[model samples]
Target chain A: MSRPVRVSPQELRQTLIEAIVEVAPDVDPTTIDPCEDLAEQLALDSVDMLATLVSVNERTGIEIPERDYPKLATLDDAVAYLVHAAVRQVDAAARQEEDSSI
Target chain B: MPSLGADMESGTLLEWRVKPGDVVKRGDIVAVVDTSKAEIEVEIFQDGTVEQLLVAEGTRVPVGTVLATLQTTSDESERAQAPSAPPPPTEGPSAERPRVSPVARRAAERLGVDITSLHGSGPNGAITLADVQGTAGSTQAARAVKPDEAPAPSVAADRQAAMRQAIGALMARSKKEIPHYYLQSTIDLSGALEWLGKANETRPMSERLLPAALLLSATAKAAKEAPAMNGFWRSDAFQPAEHVHLGVAVSLRGGGLVAPAIRDADRKSVDELMASLNDLVRRARVGVLRSSEMFDPTITVTNLGDLGAEVVHGVIYPPQVALVGFGAVGERPWAHSGMLGVRPLVTVTLAGDHRVSDGAEGSRVLALGGRYRQRPEEREK
Candidate 1:
């Protein structure tokens, strides 16, 4: 049986920074504070936020719904949200696999 | 038919925003098209009932191809009463007119040059500004002229390459065909920035206005005062746009530029302009621009402030008679009331079509833009 791969917070943070850079190349990802509000610090507008979300989704294969977008206000918050979502997705897949096997 | 841009030879019809039997009015978005740069929303020009969609979605057709049939108010009733009556003659070669860029038409008017007497040197033998300007009193009606031909279908993959090719074609044509004149003005932005600061202080972070919005608003007002710099040069003369739809240039994330029009810039408040500009920039980067926004801009405003440029002398987008460019705004030593003081200043440059308007008119537009900046409150009205 194959086990689901786990995404670490550090890896997620790197992914988030890469995604942000994809949307706004002018932004210096290294200077971004993990806990600071991205909109306030980087002047990331709504469009940039959407682009970042799309890029992260494409990179990580994780879907972040619009309703949950408000929870992802900072780099740290996004990393945490992504980690939790990935865990949930893995759990759902495992449960479905177990039911199918039975 | 709408020419989205000079580089766009053909577009693939993506989807219809309005279905058959739907009533559509002027400026109403009816269809969406996939262009070389982005997917733009296409708007119709007249009030009518959509009789049928002539072209199915996903079909790549050349520019000037009719994608749909609209029955005007009079025609709708006539067709309803006499279903068997032969339809009005289709718009065929007999009704076809010589293809001439709007700028060429306007230039021909100014120079009193007969455009029909000259051979077109532009793509598909379309009359260009240079062709009109080059042919003065020469009875060269027999000049070898090529017939109009459809541009070859572009490969959908490698969007960046297509974009580059499109940009190259347009820029090359602009530089080669248009006789451009440049004008520059140093505007004192202290008053405008002061007002913006106060206004932003009272607004939320997301709603706070950017300096670019103020500059755009001032440009629109300036366009209103200096009408010559505010419209398309077409049909042998300058056709001043009834409304100021300012096209703001935005750089995409994947490396291309698109300028979508902010409709009725003169009528909108600064806050409204800010919201629209933000939305337009976001959509432009995301590649979801509407067709009307792509083709409706009568004038273009490019702000290179964020890039840290001190001045920008931009090339005029074809059909558009003038392009207004703004450079970085910074605190500089200024002489107001004969006293030296630090004030925010920005260098404004206007690249105008010499055939349509001279440097004098371009200077007037820039001066008006500066004057509007001093009275920033008037923009809200």
Candidate 2:
């Protein structure tokens, strides 16, 4: 209903890492491999993964459907997915705004 | 510091959330304590106004030491009548003296061991029960205390070692004392999974339930039905609990495990259990669980499904009489209504204390759990 907040891939990646650290403080951001499965590498359980995802959604205001959770297994894939979702949201918001003005 | 676990001998007081003159009720978190396994928020167990804090922050003290003094609300009338009762000494005469644990002091008094003449081998040169007992056993008790041990290792590595020690000690005690018997049953979970999938279709991502929630709730409900498996073995006797508090064994991110309770699990719905389970796991991982959560579990449930374990025969935490373990739910050949077919199944195991319960009670618990789990739709309420 409003303008979607656009985020660059690097910023989205940083946001994901921050969210993870917020939930599991023992996680060292420096040790994370961007291409590796985040949960398995960090030994995070499903609840931790869900909390991290929820924190990310709270920070970015992105409505990540549950079906898309598997696509976010790795940091690189998560950033790419979020970046594309942000662009689509922005486009949809712009079209809606234009229609309302008419 | 109150005992956070069976093996927690002492804890370092990290910070006080409340100060003198603050009013605290039962279950209010008053301080944070750093144990070997995790940093836990210590809760007050009575309604009172804080009068004085005996232990300073950053000081490590043994369990049962008086950390703070409180003015109970119930004693108002007594205080009013005896206004001159010497204000209950703020500090004892032995304050600022030897750093001896309460248990060690008692042992010293009983065994006629001179505590002041000996060096402590415990953390920060604090005397422990072992130090006193060893001294009483032999003439030589002056072990060199290592106050300035080599600069401490990384916190994570140090914690890992300490956690392993704590778990090993408790497990050894369990194995040596309790006669444990294990029973395993494979439950057909096709109905529950099907019900859960349909239920999730109408909910949001955050509210969607996991299979573990169903397993936990079912175990809780089953324990309520099978009372023999729902209590503790204390004081050389079996004492059944009034309500079902299921201790959820959560594995930490780095290592170690803590089983904190979800109070009154049998009364909660599946959705409610899921929410509590999510919150409990989150808090347990963050190392901020409350004191009662650590102490109030009547029974424990360990789920190793995520790790792909087929079955778990958990060691019963001391005092508690039973442990329920749920393994991975996978497709397997099964006979349903006399027809052979492939179905989703889970292996549930029960480890019961032979001193308190026999195999019949353990079987009843597993059977009831399976029944509850089979009817996921009915439990949603």
Off by over 4 Å in 2: A1-4, A98-102, B76-154, B337-342
Ten-residue region with minimum lDDT total, candidate 2 chain B: B77-86
Candidate 1 per-residue lDDT, tens place, B50-125, comes to 8766666667777877676788977853122222222322332122234454345445655566767677754346
Candidate 1 ranges with C-alpha deviation above 4 Å: A1-102, B18-28, B76-157, B337-339, B378-381
Cα lDDT of model 2 by residue, A45-87, tens digit: 6777877887777677776776788899998999988998888
Chain B TM-scores, listed for every candidate in order, come to 0.74, 0.79
Q: Tens digit of lDDT per residue, candidate 2, span B59-148?
A: 888787777778898765112222211233333223233445433554566557799876775434656555666666676345321222
lDDT of each: 0.73, 0.78
Q: List TM-score per model, in order.
A: 0.64, 0.80
Clashes by residue pair, model 1? B40-B291, B41-B290, B41-B291, B102-B233, B102-B234, B105-B236, B106-B236, B106-B237
Worst 10 residues of 1 chain A by lDDT: A21-30
TM-score of 1: 0.64
